[model samples]
Target: MKFQDYKVTDINLADWGQKEINIAETEMPGLMALRKEYSSSQPLKGANIVGCLHMTIQTAVLIETLIALGASVRWSSCNIFSTQDHAAAAIASKNIPVFAWKGETEEEYNWCIEKTLSGSDTWAPNLMIDDGGDLTKIVHEKYPGLL
Candidate 1:
């Protein structure tokens, strides 16, 4: 995706989030190893992953690892309060669409989920990763063709 494609809380928070995401990367050896091992082969090269989870430093690490292993991703927070704006910004800075922020109403939360599930003209997800059932539920109820 292009750099201008995402809708995060703030693009300016990228530097702040990058430092933490860097620290988190150091603490995640398993993913690092996987990235080193499989990145060249790019087993997930064709993957278009839609992820709905808590947006945090840890989540950023996972998403980046997925990218390193060759998966294009879109993301959203499962809960309104669980999203870290800086983290969302960081992901979006790398041209990965991440729709989330620190606070949201029920409607906003659902909207973010829908954004991850159904992105801009350039994105069409072929896989999904969900924390709670909201993503799955919405796919079944709304975008049944994704099934």
Candidate 2:
């Protein structure tokens, strides 16, 4: 896991993150219900899900859903500039490992993707949820077995 090569601020933005998470939760009733019902079932109990998407209300819904379904998630921004810092905060507030933020430098963007893939070393995702296909491509090229 090249995680050591990446530099994350690792600071707490709790209040800001909480606000975004709350708002996303309100808009995602369907995913939320899935979380409530299936969480205990643990259908995805040992699964790992690495998602590359914009940090937004919709993405928050998806990540929380996957977690509730018993999957460990590593989230990253798809487009470098599209990440909403507040939304990233929201996801991070829940203590879901997120590796993206607004106005990230190119190095940060690549590093985040590297971190997401690193989580797969132990157990590759059974399924990947991606917005722009960057994560998918990386998995294919670097760890084709996941595909």
Best by lDDT: 1
Which digits, one per residue and each the tens of the lDDT, describe model 2 over residues 1-147? 222322223435546656767787887788878888888898988878888888766787788788878888888889888876766766665667788877788788877887877753465567777888888878878888767
**Local distance difference test values of all predictions, in order:** 0.89, 0.74
Over 4 Å off in model 1, which ranges?
120-122
* Each candidate's clash count: 0, 2
Q: 52 in model 1: Cα distance from truth in Å?
A: 0.2
**Poorest 10 consecutive residues of model 2 by lDDT?**
1-10
Superposing every Cα of model 2 onto the true structure, what RMSD results?
Answer: 3.5
What's the true lDDT of residue 15 in model 2? 66
